[model samples]
Target: ESLNKLMKNLYSTHPHFVRCIIPNEFKQPGEVDAHLVLHQLQCNGVLEGIRICRKGFPNRLVHSEFKQ
Candidate 1:
C-alpha cells in the first residue's frame, strides 16, 4: 500500500496544501479529515505512524511588554 502511505504522508506535513473536508463547522476534533503535506524529508512515511522529533519554540515575539 505504498500509494496509501504516500498519500497519508503528503497530508501530514504541509496541511495548507490540502483543503479541510468538514470546514470546521462543528469545530469537532477528528470529525473531518483532509490532505496534509510533509515538506521535511525527515518526516517522510511518518504520516502512516507516529515518530518523535525535536521541538523548538519561536524565539521572536511581537509587542512584548518587555520590549523597550
Candidate 2:
C-alpha cells in the first residue's frame, strides 16, 4: 500500500525538523511579542539547546571558517 511505502521511505532517511513560532496574534511586521516568543522557545527547548551548545563551544567562528 501507499502508507507502507511512505513509512519505508521515511525510515530510510535522516529527518530534520523545523519549528515555526508565531511572534504575535496580530501577524504584524516588525512587531514581536517578547513574552510570547520566550514562552514558545522555552516550551520547545530551543533556549536550553542553545545554552548547551554555547557552553560546549564558546569560541566564535570566523565567516570563512563557518562557511567551510
Candidate 3:
C-alpha cells in the first residue's frame, strides 16, 4: 500500500525513463543482445512519453542531486 502510493507520487511527475541495457551475459565485452536491449526500451516510455527539450536536452540534475 505504501509502495503503491509512492509509485503514484513518482509517476505524477511525468518522469522520463532511461533503460540501461545489459547486452550479454557471456562475459563478453562487446557482445550485444539486440532482443533484450530492444525489449527494455519497447516496454518502457522510450517511444511513448519521453519529454525532450527544444535543444534536445533531456533533463537537468544538479551535482548534489545526482544519484549513483
Best by lDDT: 2
Off by over 4 Å in 3: 1-17, 50-68
Best by TM-score: 2
Estimate the TM-score of every prediction.
Answer: 0.21, 0.55, 0.39
Clashing pairs in 2: none
Clashing pairs in 1: 10-36, 10-37, 11-36, 11-37, 12-36, 13-37, 14-37
lDDT: worst 10-residue window of model 1: 50-59
Per-candidate local distance difference test: 0.44, 0.83, 0.69
lDDT of predicted model 1: 0.44
Q: Write model 2 residue lDDT over 1-68, tens digit each, in one string.
A: 99999979977975545789998879899899999999999999988878988888443567996666
Q: For candidate 3, write residues 1-68 as lDDT tens digits.
A: 99999979976885545667678767589898888777776777564434445347556677786663
lDDT of 1 by residue, 3-54 (tens): 9999799758633233323434566776533332243222454433333332
Ranked by TM-score, top first? 2, 3, 1
